[model samples]
Target: MCAVSDDVQISVRKMDMRYRHETLLKDLNFDVHTQDVFVIMGESGCGKSTLLRHMIGLTRPRHGDIFYQGKSFWHCGPEQREEMMQHFGVMYQNGALWTSMTLVENVALPLKQFTTLTRRKIKHAVEFKLALVGLDGYGDYYPAELSGGMRKRAAIARAMALDPKILFFDEPSAGLDPINSKRLDELLLELRDNFGATIVVVTHELDSIFSIANNSIFIEPKVKSIIGRGNPKKLLETTDNPKIIEFLTRGERYE
Candidate 1:
């Protein structure tokens, strides 16, 4: 078993990101603690995904630094970076599965690549992960054969294949019906409770946010920065920022 320490799983200190002179994240500072369901919410184009990329060491910050488990990822050697990334599981919004592979094949690929587990062990592992995401019998199905929700579930299964300590979800509920979306939320909560994995979700869905977020950070569109951080319900009730209030109230006017 891995030891848990007070060090941040993902930490950004005064980080800034820019593309073609446009600032995406400006002076962002936050720490994602161990075993937390930390949601990042914002209007579209507020750099929520950009912030996530920085957290995972995908995009290097133009200024400041990102640390994973108390070590600066930007300064780490390639081998060290790979080791750190192995501790994380990322589920992209698009489900990012290979079209040529069956669901189980997709889920098992990570185990094959990263571990020396035999084919039998990989198959068993894949089956277990698929069942966890409610896709027990669909492992043989192709990506095109599954529904959007099922594909998402399969993608989630693949993400959990390596049993990562932290799971980063990019818009996990996108393009799903209300029922499927709600089911995904329940699965996310179950992941935290069952596996003790820290979850960081990037989303704009009110239902998902209210249902799953224990703590969250709201990025302001205009400022391109986080303006609120705390329990979602408490931040909504006490915040006077019109955008924050508007977001919490589901875009309904409060007068």
Candidate 2:
């Protein structure tokens, strides 16, 4: 097993990215410390998703390194990278559950593929994860049978299937109603506390960011780099940078 010191979970170093001829972000550097709810916040079309894909090895950065638990994800050999990937769990903008699969089956997929656990044991674990996400008895339901909130919860259960060390969420609250979005936020905090997982969230939701983020960085669209870095709440109250303040305060000063 690999050992990561308790202080840092992942590090982004001098990352440069471009699309066609347009540079999206350049020299992006940040560290997501262990067990933090780290937010990557920016307005829409800021390439947050692109950066995330690069971290997950879906896209190669033009220049830079993303370190996972002190191991260079870009520099590692295939076998080493594959070993590193086993520790990640990701949830997309939409729930992204298979419409045909029951909730338990969806959650069980990861465990069945990754571990030697028997079917019986996987079933037990699936039920536990389902219950954790407040879907204790709905594991038999298909994705299409559940409401939007329930589908998101089911997807979260699946993400937690392998007890991942780090969880990545892309716009977790994108389509939910306000109430469901709040519930999802609560669930995220619960997951972080219960699992002590490092969570990297890519979102532009101001309410969610203030409520959940322990640390964050705002991507600057104009400069093609990060403009602000720190606790969202503090930055909201203290930042003089117009873009950072405007983004966080929604152009309204704290009154």
Candidate 3:
């Protein structure tokens, strides 16, 4: 409901995530609208990252389907799914950059693998992606040469190399100090507002959950379902559920 537009970008219907016979999540249904900063937040063991994996085609749901523009992702052919995945930019919990590569080489990997662009053009594209993430002149730097935040930004540049429509992030702020986390949050909003990119983030950082997410779902591991949904600030103001309130308040008494 916090979405500015009613246009649904991704839909998860009757989804169940399981590892073998043990169900991790059940009957999960949600809609991520176009341009939404949709946060998936919960306690550590909940299925937040698992749900992200399901959405991105890295893992298949044990039951039900995930749809993009009404086409079933899980039920699609491998070729079709690979095509869909090309347009999705994912930044994992770790920056995932190869220490042996420079930023330019790292960013150019996707373009080289997926497109027919010449080496010169690929370099040009890589520079643009780096600039987009505020890393304009760091192209020659290796992952070890940068700070943690800068490394994360470098990873983001690589993810954006293909010009993805929907960007997915896993705990983007996990290792940052408060100031760096806030800067990362600002960059995410800039991506959403300036480029109209739809974003899905898996994070439990309340500061970020409130700062960036326009819409969200809080999954509870014990219940194996979503226990909270909507804007984090609004949920803090309006919800009476103890677990949710406790979560939003960091277990302090909410007036």
Model 1: which ten-residue window has the lowest total lDDT? 1-10
Could you tell me the lDDT of residue 236 within candidate 1?
Answer: 85
Better of 1 and 2 by lDDT: 2
| lDDT by residue (tens digit), candidate 2, 115-214 | 9999899999999989877799998899999888788878878988999999988888876778868887887888789888888899988889999999
Could you say which candidate leads in TM-score?
A: 1
lDDT of 1 by residue, 1-255 (tens): 123357457777888888668887688888888777899998887888878887787888898877777777877797998889998999988898999999999998889999999999999999998987788899899999988878887888888889898999998888877877877888888888888889999998888888788889999867878899987888888888888889888879665
**Candidate 1 error regions (>4 Å):** 1-7
Q: Mind giving the per-residue lDDT tens digits that candidate 3 earns over 171-194? A: 888877787678778878888888
TM-score of each: 0.92, 0.90, 0.90
Arranged by lDDT, best first: 3, 2, 1
All candidates in order of TM-score, best leading: 1, 2, 3
Local distance difference test, each candidate: 0.85, 0.86, 0.87
TM-score of 1: 0.92
Better of 1 and 3 by lDDT: 3
Candidate 3, lDDT over the whole model = 0.87
